[model samples]
Target: MTTPREHVRNAAGFALVWVAAKAAHRVRFRTMGSVPRTGPVILVANHLTMTDPLAVARVAIGHRRFPHFLAMQEVFGWPGVGALARATGQIPVARGSASAADALESASERLDQGQLVALYPEGRLTTEPDQMPGPARTGAARLALRHPEAPVIPVGTWGPKQGNGHIWHRHTACLSVGAPVDLSPWAGRSDEAAAREVTDAIMAAIRAEIAQAKQMWHAR
Candidate 1:
């Protein structure tokens, strides 16, 4: 059950996100597929820039689901930002540390609580010259395999790259939400090989969504 304090926090968090997102870019969100109103959800998206999380959050908020992101541990060290992150339940990932796996466990716990967990399976921003999504890091796949009942939704975003050099300039960002991927074929498989296959399937779905999002970006 959500407490009154939690509801207040969520409202404040969503308001902050809206202000920051609108101040940075003119975002156009399109939901090509449905996001389950209630349940555990794994939202996987392609990472383009550091601002990508804001875009994804905008989409999730539109669907009435407040996303808890798995962000780098360094972000949790910032003064006010860190405090807010902790309060809003964002998972911190300590990459290259022994405690790295702990983030996944925390994510699993959130899933068990029926919360929406969002992650960039690529692990980092895409380095592709064309800005296409890179390889998956298996974390998202592992979560999916661990919780087979949760739907893995693919989200595509474009236009944030245009604001990289001109942070003050507001550019148009286009985001498209895709349907949940069918992980039935790899259900109950936690092996590395299975994880890689599942990640590949999930990335393919994300790429398809990106392709559509790109078209929308250029047309606007």
Candidate 2:
């Protein structure tokens, strides 16, 4: 449901993002599909670089919605970056705080209120090409189970390619989005095994999306 208010907000956010991406002048690349025009959705993606999230978000904002991300507390405390981060609806995580209950509360509040959010399950930035994704903390699973019906869209970027003042403007920046992932299987699971199973399943879905995106992007 793209309410009148959200519609207005999306349009405005898109404008700002468009300007910023254009300024970066990176040749923005994308494949897969567009973010749904209307829905309570969760976005999942790889964390290969510090800018990985932002690189992925460039494509997300251009789609039919505004994206809210889960920002680490450190980033949330920075000066201008933090201000800008909050303005974009970033859910800040005070990691090490009782299994991230605070962030979950914030995510639930936003999703229940009808918003799109981006998450990096790796819990931190990536530095290598061969690392088999950091063990996901399962907080994302907890978040999704809390809202069993929201659509979870997985996104993957080919690269910011090492250093980056701007990649979105460079023609080489490529991104791919997977269809919305559903975690209904864990909707009612009560055991630890069931929980880990569900989390691994979700992680698999995200991994496939990322691998496909990376392959397709680099092939071109």
Candidate 3:
């Protein structure tokens, strides 16, 4: 169930991202319907820029779901943004500290509550010149195992990184969300080896979608 404040915050966040996206680029979302409308879901995506959460959140809202992301603790300490993040129930990741574990635990609880939990398995935005997602962190895999009932949907985002904050220059942000990664193959196993397999499969799905998005972008 959602509260009035949650609805208000989500609307505000969507509006903020929409306005920003309009100034920065023309945004397009594809295959967003693939995500389950109601239930526990783990949204795994490639991180391209700081604006990724906004873009992903926008897509989630469009598909009738609210995203609870694992964001940096420092971001939750930001002025107005921090308050909004808290209001919307975003988890804060305190890198290099026990808070990170707390964040993961919190995320698991959110999943148990049947909410959508968005995570960038790469852990951080990529610095690669090509802007591809870096290696996947083990947290995502472990999380998936802990809640095997929740499907991990791989979403690929391209173009949001191009505009930065240059309002005068318009770019295009293309997001493509694919079907959930199949985990049935490792159903009974929650061991490290199984987690590693699941992790590779999750990353592979993300990479496939990212590659497809890039091709689509370049073809345009």
Candidate 4:
């Protein structure tokens, strides 16, 4: 059941996100319907800049699903945003922990409760000059493999940042929602190899969407 505090938090968060999206000027949201309306969902997306989370949230909101991001533990301890994040139920991931067990357990609980959980498989912003997505962290795949009921959806987000500057000149960005990866084939295995395989498949889907977004950006 939804608590009064949660309801208030969600409403406030959505309002704030709308304001931020509008202030950012131009953004293109695509394939939002790929996320199902009701049920547990695990969204895996590529992270390029700090603005990626907001862009991803837009996609999820468009699909009528509220996204609970797997953010760093320190972020949840931040001054003002921390309180809001706690209220909104964002999962806190500890730094330097390879397994991210605390976060995974929280995420699993949320999934069992039929809520949408979002993660950046790359774990951090891209350092590459080309800004392509970095390696996939096993956490996302592990979560999916542990709970096979919730389908893993790959989301590609690009162009949240234009050049090295913070200001966006109404730049054209893309949020491509790819098809959900089928993980039924690896249901029983929770080993490193199975997790790696699932992570690769998810990454491939995300990369395809990224390529498509880049192509579309160029075409425009």
Candidate 5:
């Protein structure tokens, strides 16, 4: 359960991030379907750019859900950013290290506590020249298998590219949130094959949402 103090801290963090994100980009957000207002949920999204977390957070905050993101470990080492990440309860992922599994464990605990946990199954910013989502790692699928009760929601973001060196130039960003994925078929299955299948389905859902977000961005 979130303490009153933590709630206040999270709210402050959200406000700061929202304002900063707005100043950096013109963000357009939409919810294609309803996201649960309460309960534990696992949000999976395409990894577009380093700033994609901010776009996703905007959507989560709009629904009154304070998101605890599983972010890259290096981000936790940055000066002021690291302090805020820890203060807001963000989980750091030590990619390619044995300690990487610790992030999933921490995310599971957050879900058990009925908090929203957001992850990018892609694991890193997409190298795709077109900015489409790439193949996903199985951490998200494994987490879903462990907590079948928690809904897995797919989110898509567009307009944030990897090589944009213009930090001062405001860019247009679009976020689209999809409904909870149906995991009943994979229920009670925890094999490697099951994880692969689940991950593929989750990635597919995210890809579809990204297409929708891209259309929204173009229409804007």
Candidate 6:
């Protein structure tokens, strides 16, 4: 039941946390393309670690924008994070719901109001830095097509925000955003069989961008 008004509130709250986190951690977010400054937009990014949101938030503030994260219900279940998620307008979805209808409705409403929605199509963090993004879901594609006029930005993030033990364990991390992909052509094809085509294309584009970032990160 996240409405456009909810996302606006979430954006405001995220801004405060982003400011504190970035300033305290000295983490920097870099962008490879001009982030759409406004409109019903979607930011599709690779999941590196739990701190992925921090990186995205920093970049958003740096770019002078606010983006709402489509988070998992588990994160919101935590007492503190749950409270934060509710206050900031972050969308929390169940791990395996009957249909992603609730999430879609919430996202559609936000997009209709011309707000940016950030989603991780992979459904979870990447254990292997180079593993091809697990077959992505079509939610993001559908969301993009819902707001065809808005930008469906494909983004790739590499490295770690601080720890270097694994996904959450890198001394430093970098983010790279690729050109936006428009999915208006596949908007109405909601059937699973038909949606797979759209999902594949988006996943391919995201993987391509992640590959580019992976190479750059390893080279350094």
Q: List model 1 lDDT by residue over 90-165, tens digit each.
A: 9999998999999999999999999999999988888888889866799999999999989999988888873256
Best candidate (score: lDDT): 1
TM-score of each: 0.94, 0.82, 0.87, 0.89, 0.95, 0.80
- Write down the lDDT that model 6 would get: 0.70
Worst 10 residues of 6 by lDDT: 161-170
lDDT per residue for candidate 2 within 1-220, as digits (tens), equals 5579866765666676666555543535554564776667888777765556556667776675677888788888888768767666678888877757788788888888777878887687655556346677676776776677687777766645544444444445566677767666666764667657767877887777667766766786
Where model 4 places Cα greater than 4 Å from the true spot, the runs are 162-164, 167-171
Superposed Cα deviation of residue 10, candidate 1 (Å): 1.7
Model 5 regions more than 4 Å off: none
Model 5 residue 168 lDDT score: 62
Off by over 4 Å in 3: 1-25, 162-170
TM-score of 2: 0.82
Off by over 4 Å in 1: 162-164
Give Cα-based local distance difference scores for all models.
0.88, 0.69, 0.82, 0.82, 0.87, 0.70
- Model 3's alpha-carbon lDDT is 0.82
lDDT of 2: 0.69
User: What tens digits encode model 6's per-residue C-alpha lDDT throughout 98-163?
Assistant: 755688789888888777788888778776545556667778766665566778777776666322
Q: How far out, in Å, is residue 155 in model 3?
A: 0.5
lDDT of 5: 0.87
- Model 6, C-alpha of 211: deviation from truth (Å): 3.0
Backbone clashes, candidate 4:
0
Compose the digit string of candidate 3's lDDT tens values, residues 68-148. 899988898889778878877899999888668888899999999999999998888777788887677788889999998
Ranking by TM-score: 5, 1, 4, 3, 2, 6
Residue-level error in angstroms, candidate 5, position 151: 0.9
